[model samples]
Target: MTAGSSPRAVVRRYADVTGHAPVMPEWGLGFWQCKLRYWNQRQVEDVVEGFRRRGIPLDVVVVDFFHWPHMGDYRFEDEFWPDPEGMCERLHAQGVKVMVSVWPQVALSSENYDLMRQNNLLIHAEKGEDIAMMCWEPCTFVDVTNPDARRFVWDLCKRNYADKGVDAFWLDEAEPEYGTYDFDNYRYYAGPNVEVGNIYPLEYNKGFYEGQLEAGREGRIVNLTRCAWAGSQRYGALVWSGDVGSSFQDLKAQITCAIHMGMAGIPWFTTDMGGFHDGDIEDPQFKELFIRWSQFSCFLPVMRNHGNRSLSHPHADDPSLAALDAPHERLLKEEGEFKEVVRAQDGSPRFYSGADNEPWSMGKEVEAILVKYITIRNKMRPYLRELFDQAHKDGDPIVRGLFYEFPQDHRAARLSDEYMFGPDILVAPVVQAGARSREVYLPGGEETIWENLSDGQIYHGGAWQTVEAPLDVIPLFARQGKDQGLRKAIQEASA
Candidate 1:
């Protein structure tokens, strides 16, 4: 790479070393709905049915963590998830795909723990207790660095999920987040944690990718993960910013993060639409933040909404209550035995839950705003297909910095809040709260023209213009000379 090399040249060098980015699955290019959880089989099905009744376009509905009996039980709990196959069949019948969450930590009470422990397939603590992570229960991470361990976990997933019509996996806790960040005390199969920690997410995705391929499933492997290393893109890893706060500052950080992730060679990136933590659904302030974040997310490579929305009523019926009452209650009951309770560092039993995060979970006013953007995202599918094709064939990022497209535009080099959704569309999301307008910079040659998608106003390129941005408006513009079909789609959707 030369000193003044162009952005394309820099990205090309990255691809040459890491391999071209995976072609995004068509379903992935549409709207995906997720939250902290959907507790039982019926709840999951009802949510999918709700989307249909509401006329919302949902391509994927995720079953977040704790769908299983234990943290490490690869299979669904027979008690809560009475009919996995039937649930998947019903969802597929509705033209929706299912994505199940899988974590790297295996609890000591898990059925597979003894076998993994005996085979040295779990990470070990070099000092004090043997626990490598302590979430919900004392557990250790699977040594994904070991090929045999990867096969073991993948085989379990294949038998439990793939055979039951599950379309993808959410590889959560890919960071192998420890209860404490004592990197010096942990040891992995490859080496110590600090020495090889960054590679965990890559191998985490690989385990599922290879498993899907070996099972003869032909569709592209797309797995949602929390973190990624350099070459994780080759394994079809869609990395999202992890457990962010619900604030305007956090939302602004996501834009810069997405741009840098693309520059770093991982083009598949998304964020929790309304941050991941402390978002009270009933708070007027929080609702405003959620609306703004949702608008920004519409232009990302993968349009998905996820977070732990704060709940006002915690006593809602949930399977997790049983686990919280006695961390080993369900597991011990199934095994015909009894054990002591598992408590977190704070002496209280570890329990987690979030409020309803569906399109209608909030009030109708918020619901209307979410539905409008989701409809626009769905309408742009034809344009998205072309964008994904370009990404696959030329290593072009679907969501990139303005500088990537206009390397010579000196002003573009510093524009971080606005970005190019692709070569044709410039997205200027309102990152601040209570802002009714925003200034947008359109970059191109002298002959270029820019058309505003919201009001159909046209402007000459290589200049700045302030645009109106109401609650429902995201400042989006199309470069006039290219992709007329895409331009028309934006116009129709805005209309």
Candidate 2:
């Protein structure tokens, strides 16, 4: 994966659905696998209704992968959705844009399979043979590198964008399928000998980005790529850390990882909203963890919830994956028995078996914390909008660290665990559990106001403050003129 190219390189004002540069939100909301179930339609409609009823400002609603009738069929089932355009129009009327997940591979014995085969638009192995890999479907990777292949893919998107009236795309699983565990092995008609495995998402997204560009006015590309390589940022994309497991350690690591990514030149940074793996939020203690995680997540560019729905599973990384292995290994050669060859790939079709990471951890108590922050977030929409404006005008991140705003201060340079949200605010979240107090170092700015909205108490801030938070508070500090209030007019409110 290519790492270094240029940062401040102006890719130009992006063309979008409105024929102008889209004003990216202060942050976004994601309901991962939660939005894809049979009951999801009812749940989604009810939620959308709830938001509409409450006048909640929702910028985007991500519909995750395979919402269509048959998995990998890519057809919007008339049963599930008789009218896709009608759905989009309704959502748009409520000022909500839909960004749905789409995969790059076409499954075996499908129409897309025949299409790729006829055009030779799929990927191939190093030996110039078909390189099939394991995915949910007996899927073969599409050669997004080829011009004709790109055009074909864009055509598919155009149907969704123009005919169906969708808004954006969340390109999922762009990582080229590789490994001995898979069963299928079809050669892709992509760039010659592109052995790069992890770099696939970058290559994969280039088409969507450009296609959206070529789409003229019907679409805007908002790719939530899981596996991104270098130079992936130029496509005007937002990337989340791949399949992060749920754990306090992982939560802390997520913060560090986002900071590292920011330093590496990726401005829009995020991970799974609640940790994607391990821990039971059903337990009161863990529910508190999820609530705390959500409190911190609002500051990120994109907030997404992913992974297993069930909370009863043990917290193991690779516990009892399914028996249906990738078909790449089995499709070729004289493999003895189909049963023996069907080595089930990791996890079930819709479930990640490893760990249990669910929201509603710590239950209503945690919900109270999240709701409080969400209220504050709602209140700060005006100022937050200004930040988003700046991010679009100049490549800047919504949530920055302490040092980024205080580069001159050696103390700020030393504070990696904590960071400044923008130019003024400092956020030092309690990354660990069972912690009454966490250490926070400021840049010794001119003035620091430590305001705990929970208690309506304000503390003077400048140096390190090892405050006793007790797991219910997010330590937020205002550098100086931090009293910016909400800008958007609240027509009708539901407190």
Candidate 3:
């Protein structure tokens, strides 16, 4: 917390193979699951070739939960993947990096479980027993708060980073919870064992961040986790809201919830782009949700197309939603549902409340709105980079509410979903129903320039702009003279 503290070094005391700070300039895209078989030597070549063909800036490809054949047995599938080292090396050659997901609970039947269990490397309750598995495994959670446990996880990473040439690891399902087990007297390494809801994920990622620093390398090291804790930011970890269902309200809440997380020090966060819960590859609603958010996600820090990827295409067979926004996107045979206006094929249709509040099944208008916002994001990469730098150096978010930046404007506090990415831009996304237009409150003295991302319309500062924001466009504004206000106000103020 001091001026001289090495954020990286303080973090390194906990993990296995510490490396350097992230230095990569390009942003990345992630997915919810990864397929092990299709990721073999020859298969990876085809995958890399596919990305090159799409011309997508596919820098980091995530190999999520699917990579693990079973719990604790963490090794490449030799029969299916004869050469993982070769696959990674080839992906790197194609300018694409590999990221594998790792869970904290080592499976009881895993090849590596005995090594950890016998050494007491897993998390134990305060009563001093190994933490029981809740969701993903039959093993206990690792006590990340412990030194030995930290080293154990890091050692695994070292083998991956140095031996297999994996670019990064996505720390997944670290949300430590207990099932049907009642006693709150759970164990921890040394700290007081508390009924911590989701702290393990944070510790899991923190351990990895430390390991990355010790390796003396500086590239964007990401921890795409399902859970997190305070100070997890220092570890370069990002959290997506979790596996949610495909209800329209969930989508609306995601926007506001993410804003809240950003204000709480997690500027780099998003949710299941398309809802994540139980729909199959053929769900029409799911398809539309994917396209709409995939377009919206283009503007976010990390882009990922997750959920049930085993299907050949996500409702691409349905050409129903292709009226307004299908003009520029890569509409595959399975990806066309998001291009037009249509009704949801399933789910509680009542969730589609209004213009911005409607689900993808509402129509093409919403999809168009998302597409327009994405175009703006692509154009503002330079500015996004500026905010990312602030996040790295000073914990500033790429997006934030107006009050955090302009606390003096007491009125700024009310705009929860509407926030500024830094000192320059203001984003007031629509998150309610039955509303064709919305109200925007501006700071009294600050100058703003609203360059509509959907259309190139520019609105001047000093007043609220009652602009028409069809479902396709969120109200976005840039402060015209943000720096000048500070300089002028400080004419006589000094540090």
- Candidate that scores best on lDDT: 1
Off by over 4 Å in 3: 1-25, 28-47, 125-131, 134-137, 181-183, 195-199, 279-284, 309-379, 430-449, 460-466, 469-474, 480-495
Give per-residue CA lDDT, model 3, range 1-495, as digits (tens): 222233222323322122222432464533222332233346556655754664433556555553444555556545545677888888888777777767676767777777887787766555554547644446776778777887777887677544687767767666655653544666566554555544566677878877877875456577777776766765777788777765556766666666666655665776655666543344455555555455445445665545433233435454533532443322223343221122222321111111111122224554344434433444455656666776665555555656666655667766655666566656665544434467766654435455543344566644676756554445555554443232221222211
- Model 1 segments beyond 4 Å from truth? 1-4, 313-352, 483-495
TM-score per candidate:
0.90, 0.75, 0.71
For 1-495, candidate 1 gives per-residue lDDT tens digits of 322278878786777778666777788988999987676788789999999998889999999897776777799977678899999999999999999999998999999999999998888889999887777678888999989999999999989999999999999999888889999898889999889988988899889888888887645679899988988887888889989999999998999999998888788889998999888787788899999999999889888989877654334464545674553442222122222232334454423445778989878988988888888888788888887777666667778899898998898889889999888889999988899899888987677798887777899889999999998888988887554354565555545
Q: Least accurate stretch of 10 residues (summed lDDT) in model 1?
A: 331-340
Tens-digit lDDT track of model 2 for 2-118: 222332222112211112223553334332222222223443455566556654445666666556533335555454456678778887787767677777767675567776767
Winner by lDDT between candidate 3 and candidate 1: 1
Cα RMSD of predicted structure 1: 5.8
Model 2: CA > 4 A from native: 1-40, 53-57, 69-72, 127-131, 177-199, 217-220, 279-281, 313-363, 445-462, 486-495
lDDT of 3 at 375: 39
For every model shown, the clashing-pair count is 0, 34, 32
lDDT of 2 at 2: 23
Task: Indicate the worst ten consecutive residues by lDDT in candidate 2.
Answer: 10-19
Sliding window of 10 residues with minimal summed lDDT for model 3: 348-357
